[model samples]
Target: MAEARRMPSETAPAGLRERKKEETRRLLREGAARLFAERGFEGTTVADIAACANVSVRTFFRYFDSKEALLLPDGIKVFAHVEDALAGRPADEEPLDAVCNALLAAAEPFAASTLTALGHPLEDIENVVTGRLVQAFSAFEERLTVLVRRRLPADTPDADLRAAVIAGAALSTVRAVLRTRRARRASGMTETGPAPLPRAFEILREIGSAGRP
Candidate 1:
């Protein structure tokens, strides 16, 4: 009998392919951040970022819609994750606690790597990406309002206004902490020093309570 021909090894699993894609995207993001920092966002080109990432321009486009998207590499994912976190909170949990926890969860990645692959601090990137950051935060505020509204009693008076105020306050608290941390770092503070997230959360909780009837 003729020997049965063996088929090539099964195609790579979906999970493996996804992991590879994510890895490629991450490399491109880091590469772009470094190049943008070194050469300035306007000075850097897509081709330059692709070269730095060792990927083709096509591959870069696959991961990011445009160079500006590099400013917040995982902006959509971060906000989506925060929304999911808020949705998963215990039904009876205080609105403040839910929002604070969601924000903290979303901040984990930044806390893990406070600096870019190029060894430039995040604050430096923030300075370069302020415009993009504002746009991202505006989107964040809308989502946050929805989340806050869901946590409030349906019959509450001026629920929309209250939700907007809470969302604005919460975001402001986070931004304030970020500014303080950046200033402290600029003053030569150690990287391992106290974190500002906790303080920000504390203030958020206070704001939440104050808004309650």
Candidate 2:
């Protein structure tokens, strides 16, 4: 996060320059997040992201190797592992169940928040833009849709739509879980549940009985 130049007399010109750099970096990240949301990840290019940020293409490269890089360090690799995990699921498993299990199986890489893993303290997560946070859930939902489609019969009517809905629901609990963790952190409370990722799925199961008699 950038240090704000709150008062004109409080900082030197050099400090103000540093603040400008921080602002540019932040703008670039936020721009990438918006672009990712507007266009699918693979569909968005570095130039598009740079233009969205109002920065030069070269400056975009200076900050990140690719647009997806804004989502996380080694984000490409993390997504690949998730795709591979999904591919190896049991053929007979339910699509939603398979995706949740696959994410759990590959959960180690996601054990830490992207910003925290990048060395930012928990509270300094202001740079973790909200749209960027949505990227993980969007990315996983996209992966689930593609992989779940493969698992369904070719003749399955509206297979793509079905996969997408399942994908959306598949991570609905994850969104809930992330909110819970954030609220706990903000309140200076500690988690007493089982391990965090598994605990999220436990929530999925608990709520799975939503309308049962």
Candidate 3:
């Protein structure tokens, strides 16, 4: 019997390798967050992350080229998930409601964890989160403005501008809420609180409706 020769590039093995790579990436992220929180992000190095994940420095490099990438997490995935949530909303639903639901749903992971389970101490975490939110929302506001303009009727002037203003307001509201929540926690309020995203949107909607001509 003649034996079949295998090709140089076998897809099944490649797919399995990719899956393992993804697993390593996630483990490294978790390990990095924990380490960064414990020792401070500035103090942590690639070697520390690798050691925490039980992987070699070379393997860590394969997953993330630098330490900053670990802290940022997956922006593309987060945005895509949020976009999908917005898309799922009923066509007649108010724009604010749609956006609010999407953001809150996307934030479920943070909501599920205890305040301290986020790994970083209050001040450090606030800096990291606030910096990232500012960057992300700055870009997201532009995209959302375009989306809102396109989705709404053509007769609407300044749709894009209005959308951008709403998005900025939403981001500000969320940031303020998070700051308040952190302060409340610090003051010995141990209650597991609801995410402020939805509440922020509610306020935005109220204000928008009131200000309407």
What are the runs in model 3 whose C-alpha is more than 4 Å off? 1-17, 33-45, 54-62, 65-73, 111-134, 183-195, 211-213
Q: How does candidate 3 fare on TM-score?
A: 0.67
Ranking by lDDT: 1, 2, 3
Please write out the lDDT profile of model 1 over residues 1-213, one tens digit for every residue: 233332223334666789999899888887886786688666889999999989999988898888877766456766787788788888898776777777777654543442444465545555445444445555678779988998999998999998888788766766676666667666977656446787678766776569688
Task: Give the deviation of candidate 1 from the true structure as CA RMSD.
Answer: 6.0
Score candidate 2 by lDDT.
Answer: 0.68
Estimate TM-scores for all models.
0.65, 0.56, 0.67
Give the least accurate 10-residue stretch of model 3, judged by summed lDDT.
Answer: 1-10
Give lDDT: candidate 3, residue 202. 73
In angstroms, give how far residue 13 of model 1 lies from its true place.
18
Indicate the TM-score of model 1.
Answer: 0.65
Go through the candidates in order and give the clash count of each.
Answer: 0, 0, 0
Q: What RMSD does each model have against the real structure?
A: 6.0, 15.6, 4.7
Cα miss at 206, model 3 (Å)? 2.9
Against the reference, the lDDT scores of all candidates come to: 0.71, 0.68, 0.66
Best by TM-score: 3
Which has the higher TM-score value, candidate number 1 or candidate number 2?
Answer: 1
Report residue 124 deviation for candidate 3 (angstroms): 5.4
What is the C-alpha lDDT profile of model 3 across 1-213, one tens digit per residue? 123345434566998998999899978988877877677777888999999889999989887767765655456655676677778877877666666766777654543342245454545554555455445555566666665555566676787776776566765666666666667666867646454656666777788789578
Error of 2 at 91 (Å): 1.6
